[model samples]
Target: MFRIFVIAVLPLFFVFSSEIFTFLSGALCPSCNCESAKPLHRIPRPQLRPEFLALENGTDARLGCEDVGYKMHVFSREPLVVYFENFVSAREREHLLDISEKIYTPSTITHNGGQTSDRNTKVRDSEVALVPRTEGVRCIERRAREVQGWREEVWIERLRVQRYNPGGHYSHHFDWSSGRGGWGRVSSFMVWVHGEELEGGGTEFPRLELRGDKKKWCKFIECEDNLDGEDSKDKGVETAEDKKGAVFKVIPGNAVYWENFRSDGTGRGYNETWHAGLPVKKGVKVGLNIWSYGRID
Candidate 1:
C-alpha cells in the first residue's frame, strides 16, 4: 500500500514540476503559450506601462514619469509628434511577420495581383495581431496624453497590419469612429517597417480653406503637387501650413505618430486631419497601425 501511494505521489510531483517549469520558462500556459501561439486576424494591442497605471492608481498623481506621459519631451494640444528612430527590432520584426502569416491568412480582400485593400473601416472585420512590444508605442501615447492634459487610462484598443502591394492604395478617410458607444480614441500612430521608393501613395489631409478660390491655397501649399502633380486637381486641394498634411513617408524602421484628439479634449475631430492613401505606383508598403484608446477602467 505504501509503495502504491508513493507511485501516485510521484506522478503528482512531476506534473507540478512541469507547471513550475513552464512558468519559469514562460512557455506553457493553460490559456496561452507565447512561444507557440500567436494573435490572429487582428492588430496588436498597445504596450502600456504597468508603472504608469500604478502611479495613477497610487497617490501623488503629480509625480510624473520622466518618459511616460508626454511624447518626445514636447507638450502640445494640437497633436504630439514623435520621430520613429526605430520601431521594431530585426528579430522581433521578423517574428511579427511570421506570426502575422499564421493569423493573417489573407483572404481575397487582403491579397491580390500586387494590391490589397480593406474597404470596410470597421475594426472587427480587419485582421490583427497581439504584438508583445511597446517601447515605440508607449513613447507616442504618453506624450499625446500629456499634451492633451486628460487623465484617462490609455490602452491599445486594437492594432491591424495592412499591406499594400504595388499599385495598392486606400482612398481618403478619417481614422476616428463615427460616434458609436466608443468615443475615447484620442489618437493614432503608423510606424513604417520597410522603406522604399514608391509613388502615388501619400497620406493626404484636407487643407484649411482659403479666403478666395481654394485652388489658390492649394497652389500655395503645393502638397498635392509634391506627390502627384498640378493635373491631379480633382482630388480636392486645401492649403496647409508648411505642408502639414497627414500624407507622409518615413525611412524603413521609422514611425509616423499622429494624435486624433486635440489638446482641449472636447472630443472634436480635426477637420484638417481628414486624410487618405493615394494609389501606390510601385513597390509594396508594409506598416503597423497603433491606435491608442482613452481611459478604460
Candidate 2:
C-alpha cells in the first residue's frame, strides 16, 4: 500500500516542481516602464491676476503664456512660501531698487564662456536691475526663513542682476554651474522687477526627456530684431492685467518660476533644469536672482 501511494504522489510533485522552476528561471515576464520614450505635452499656461498668478486648482498649474512655452510656479506641499508682489507702492518699489543699487560693487568680470562666482556677479552695476545682499540687505536670508524646515544661517550664497542691453544676450544656458566646487544649491529663484515687450527675448523651456528619451535641452529665442533693427517688443507672456509691451517697456510687472523636478521622482531640482536669456534687442532687461545653498556646516 505504501509503494502504491508513493507512485501516485510522485507524478503530482514533479508537475508542481516544473511549474515553479519555469517561473523562477524567467520563462515568463511582464513589461517594464522603459520600453518607449516621448516628450510630454506642454502644460497649459495658468491665468494671471494683477501681480500674482492664480493658485487655484493646483500649484503645478501653468501661469504665464508665451509663444514657445509657459511659466510654472513650483513649491513644496503648501502654497509658495516665497511670494511675488507688484502691489508695492511706487515709493516702496524705488526703495527696494535703491537698496539693490547701493549694495552692488563689481569685483570681477568674465567675457566669452568664462565664469565668475555669483557673489562676484552680484556686485556689478546695471541700468536694469540690482542684486545685493551684503552687510545691510539680506533678502535671501529673509526668504530662507519664510520656507518651512529651512532654518540655517541664511547665506546669500551668490546674488546677481542681469543688465540685458540691446543685442546682449546670455545665450542658451543652465543656471546650475559645472565647476569642480559648485554652489551645491538645493533651491533657486528669480524675480523680474520690470517687464519687457521686446520681441526676440522670451524665456523658454524645451520639452523634457521622459521615459526612455535621451535628449533634454531648452532654448530662449531673442525674437528677431524688428525691421527698424530694434526689438519689435512683441508682447512677452500675457499677464492678468491685460497689459503688454514692445521694445523695452517693463509694464507687465510680473514674475516667472520653474524648478528642476521630474514626474517619476527620479531627478529633481538643479540637475535637470536647462535655461537661458534671449538677447535684448531694444532697451535694458533687468532681473534679480537668488540661489539657496543646502546647509554646509
lDDT of 2: 0.37
Question: Which candidate's lDDT is highest?
Answer: 1
TM-scores of all candidate predictions against the true structure: 0.49, 0.43
Q: Using alpha carbons, what is the TM-score of model 1?
A: 0.49
lDDT of 1 at 261: 45
Using TM-score as the measure, the top candidate is 1
Q: List candidate 2 stretches off by more than 4 Å.
A: 1-92, 100-136, 139-141, 148-155, 178-183, 196-200, 208-253, 260-272, 295-297
Predicted candidate 2 versus true structure: per-residue lDDT over 62-159, tens digit per residue = 32212212233222222122223342234333444666665544334343323343423233323433344332224333432344254443233344
Segments in model 1 whose C-alpha atoms lie over 4 Å from true places: 1-77, 105-151, 179-182, 208-246, 295-297
Task: Give a tens-digit lDDT track for model 1, residues 1-297.
Answer: 999999989978887986666565533332222342222222234445553221232333443324312123211224454434445455444544664555653322332311365535331222344443343333333443454455555655444555666655655556654322224455666655544785545545554232323343342223444336553435555434333444455345555556664443233445544555565577766666666565321
Model 1 lDDT-worst window of ten: 68-77
In model 2, the worst 10-residue window by lDDT is 212-221
